[model samples]
Target: MKSAHSSWETPDPGYWTKQGYIIVRTDERGSGQSPGLLDTMSRGTSEAFFDVVEWCSEQPWSTGKVGLLGISYFAGTQWRVAARKPKGLAAIIPWEGMSDYYRDRVRHGGILSDRFIDFWWKNGVQPNQYGMPGRAARKWGRDTIEGDLDKATLEQNRRNQTLDTVTHKFRDEDYYKTRDYSPEDITTPLLSVANWGGILLHLRGNVLGWMRASSEHKFLHFIVGRHDLPFYYAHCARLQRSFFDCFLKGNDEDGWKSGKQPRVKLCLREGDAGVDDPERELLFPHREEIDWPIPDTTYTKYYLTAEQQLSTTSQSNVTSFAYDAMEGKPLCFTHKTSARLEITGHIVAHLTVSASRSKADASPPSDIDLFVTLRKLDQSGNEVYFTGTMGDPVPITKGWLRMSLRKTNATNPGHHKYLPYRDYFSTDVEKIAENEHYEVDVEIWPTNVVLESGQSLVFEVAGHDTQGVGKFSHEHPEDRKPEDFAGINSIHIGGNHSFITLPVIARG
Candidate 1:
């Protein structure tokens, strides 16, 4: 839905129209034929979306009820718009879309996710600008109905997301605050679908959105596969139609009619289902839960041993592991188990960490970038990868944090031991000093995987991204300058700073 390119067909008209639905897609302001300022995720864009939904609900051909559904950009906007609670808005199906713009898209752990922003701007936004010429020739969309704007006017009207993201580092800044809204305000009937492999982006936001929304009729469902394919799958389509049919059309072929359906439905990932294998996906096991976090989920801590091993025993001893900030290698600790352990729900890592000067360094770094990865290995010891966004192989999950941005908002209602919440405000920047140990918690993205006997789990911490980052990378030269982030990083393993909390589900 980037710029609503107009030719993108993930909506599948044949599928919706045949179900007696009128499919209406818009080229939102400054996208395609619409002429105005081109601000992708600002409050202005959300207001426009809110207005358009109300407009659709008022049309003479309308049934006075409207349900919102879309993937990626289209889906991400739904949370903000639905929070406004416009007239006749009935339900929303935000499949694989992020709800939090700051946490999910622009910044990862307070670090600028500049690569994806630049890539999206050039390929997704620039070509489809309101006044761009030759759009029809390029097959992007029809050109501006009003004569194209001059280069100066065009440049002045749009916000460069990459530039704005780089310029603003904290949530309190007007740049991000203008885009922020409370998900708790969204009371629309909702069915939010998350992807296990959306490690670098929407995974965390989707899960949080479902939890924070005020909708009594909300449900959280999960799926696996490439980004665009799963949304159009027959089974997923049936699920969507059933949800909207019940809420918008006053008919429920499924249990949604009486709201007796489980609030959480999950795809159980036990082994390597392989990437984008649609046939095998249908056979994956599933579980239905009346509440998330499973109620019986025991938050167990895994400690780091002197030998860099992860264990359940309380091995109390001072141990240190160091990695070169610029060396591009990570310190890994693996845990192997013989019992079936279903690790689901929220995950967090507690570590006593510090930065120091390496021999190759001219000066010590002022902060550390902790890139954490949780991985699964088969019985024979080969690493197992799951289907991530765009069908790439990713680890079980990933988390990130900057030592300077390690301050936690413990007073906030959303903060919990299972998930360390941070406002990422300008005031939360606690700069690191050399040789001083500071305790920090990193919020890993939510995941679901059943560990079979002899399978292993590995947790990694590094000064840079390890793997499965794809285009959503934080490699902007300004944000991660060598002088500020390149030196030596250390993890103090013992007591409160050396363990990861996993949501261990009791096997039946």
Candidate 2:
């Protein structure tokens, strides 16, 4: 059900047992001790998980009230299973898990995130696959209870995530469509923990789940620190225990039954803090709000000027900046902060752009891949970085878009200010005619940063990955052909054609 060898960073059984609660650890189908066709994240696997949760409700010694809790893959499964509305499922805490497979994991803004898919398949998923040879000797997990399958059988037993990811380009594909679910169907009482540092994969899903799930008791808590460590933090554990105790045991000691608790709790990244430093990360502040993106957020726009600058007023003249579609430094614009302020929520960039042939004889590129980065700079013009998933000092946030999939779903209810929802389906694809300027809105992942009076922001536009992508890159050759995506990309910052909409919290 999950990719982490079914170890899942599950907490000690003895601790919960001592609290008069029984904890059951499961090696889901085709993982750990369980044996079956290995199809991680497949619909069939999720159905099996649904059966298990229902069975737990029928157990004689069980309270008939089940609470699901885990990290990453384990957490991600909670969302899918809960969507089934399994009987006796009381509550869930999906810590740092991705909800949308296509948008969050396989593809980013429509580009195939093949690098992370390859890395995760080898390191996190395949090695722990049931009956994988040498799992016992190499300490991946216990040897299979049954005799291990042979080489050919092993290869045939599992779904190849890498191959499938390459094959499935859009959400409408059978491979991806079958995995999709409505977040509103997840009606379980939920505590969805999102990590701001998990910008690459887990961050967006967690936020979206919190925003879209129909659970009235659902709460969104944004934490800071390593994904591995934050979930087990003493404060986080206390939060989990209180939530579970209220729902599972009928003990509402924390007033979770009523509206006493804050629906949204956010970890404030105000000043400079080192990546992966838990002590310093916890040193940051915490704020309570009623909703995600804050209801009163002032979505301010920073205009991309013809002078190749980020300004408040648009220049009268038209202008454009160019960069090699498959190479070269990103074009950047800076805006110095005049007052101390905090920007904490979703971010979106509006751009007018086109692709073309590099030379007279070269062929035109029919597609363009746009990579945008929002970086923080100190008063002295030095760059500031936040903690990335791998401890890499990354920008405040990043966004991407494949030019052909630039059509926005404005009619959808989810589409709103500060965020543009795009259906990355085959039918949603727009023809990217060469040299035709198209206006598109790029959805940036949620982020948080408090800037001092002199601190500034750098808005970077590029044709390829900038800082903070880490191992999750999109460089698949067939998917990004040179003739279709490796030419010249130009950003037309004329009038209102190009600008970035930043989420600003208005201090009342």
Best by lDDT: 1
Instruction: State residue 327's C-alpha deviation in candidate 2, in Å.
Output: 1.0
Model 1 poorest 10 in a row by lDDT: 1-10
Task: Tell me the whole-model lDDT of each prediction, alpha carbons only.
Answer: 0.86, 0.85
TM-score of each: 0.97, 0.96
Error of 1 at 243 (Å): 0.7
Residue 147's lDDT within candidate 1 is 72
What is candidate 1's lDDT per residue for 1-508, written digit by digit as tens? 1123223524766778778988888787887888888999889998998888899999999998999888888788889999999998999988888988888898888878888889989998888899987888998767788978888988898988878889999999999898999999999999999998898878888899998999979999988888877787777888888899999999876778476788999899987788778677667799899788678899999987778889887576788988898665899999998888889999999888888888653787898988899999989999888888878888899888888888888998899989888899998787788889988899889999888889999999889877888888889999999889887888888765689999999874
Q: Which stretches of candidate 2 lie over 4 Å from their true place?
A: 1-8
Per residue, candidate 2 scores C-alpha lDDT tens digits across 389-460 of 777777888899998898888898789877888888899887688889999999999998888888988899
